[model samples]
Target: MFSKACEYAIRSLIYVTEKSKNGERVSVTDISTAVESPFAFTGKTLQKLVKQDIISSAKGPNGGFYITEEQAKANRLADVVSLIDGNAVFQGCGLGLKICKENQPCPLHQNFKEIRKQLKKMLQSTTVAELAESQATQKTFLNNINRN
Candidate 1:
């Protein structure tokens, strides 16, 4: 339900968070490779995250993206979603109608309302730190794994 950029942002942030726990900074190239996103697109998405202060960066030879302990614990997936995609997912019509609203509901509007509410709650409740820990411990995987 998220845009490609948003997807990349979430994955890259989680990757950065995982590395940050070990006190490492991650280059955009590394993040792109790990998340399987296009290099330039990942770089751009990362810049947006940096601009929004969802993550931090440096500018020297050793400069890269890293998150603070406070940020990892405080930032929610909803923040990234709001920054990259706005509240559209939470506030927009389920069927992509430009004018759908409560009074003039789309066919799927009523059915989708509860779903959207739940999604909003999940995103708001989930911290980047939790996802990073999940990845670090192999409890979850963000990128596809090739069994072959």
Candidate 2:
């Protein structure tokens, strides 16, 4: 599971990419609504993503957040996860043990380790462009609402 911030970051980035792929900029309000996140929280998350260079933004009458073609092609879900949540999901103890490890294994350590490896692989293999493409092609929906 991802942190709330991470969830918003992923959703917002995907939404931005969906709009930006055609050279359109996305506003914070629009991004928050599209992603179903709080306006202020989404704004803060976007700022962090901008700082990390995971996305880009500008200020003015025609300014908003947009992803460059190179950025969209290069970024993976794991990159966003790492930038927002560090390696906590991949490295933290599954059972919340203070010092769980392979040597001093927790009850769920071995099983959880395998799960983590699979998750890391999936995230690494999934790029922002792929996600945006899936959405654009109507293969996926970012929000729970029925568009129809």
What is candidate 2's lDDT per residue for 1-148, written digit by digit as tens?
Answer: 8999999999999999989988899899999998899999999999988998889998999899999978888999999999889999999999888999879999999999999999999999999999999998878999767456
The runs of at least 3 residues in candidate 2 whose Cα sits more than 4 Å from the true structure, single-residue gaps closed, are: 146-148
- Candidate 1's error at 114, in angstroms? 0.7
Kindly provide the TM-score of model 1 when superposed on the true structure, using C-alpha atoms.
0.95
Clashes of 1: 0
Evaluate all candidate structures by whole-model CA lDDT and list the values in order. Answer: 0.93, 0.92
Candidate 2 lDDT for residue 30? 96
The per-residue C-alpha lDDT of model 2 at residue 89 equals 98
Q: In model 2, how many backbone clashes occur?
A: 0
Candidate 2 has a TM-score of 0.95
Candidate 1 weakest ten by summed lDDT: 139-148
Candidate 1, 1-148: lDDT as tens digits: 9999999999999999999998899999899999999999999999998898889999899899999999899999999999999999999898999988889999999999989999999999999999999898888888767222
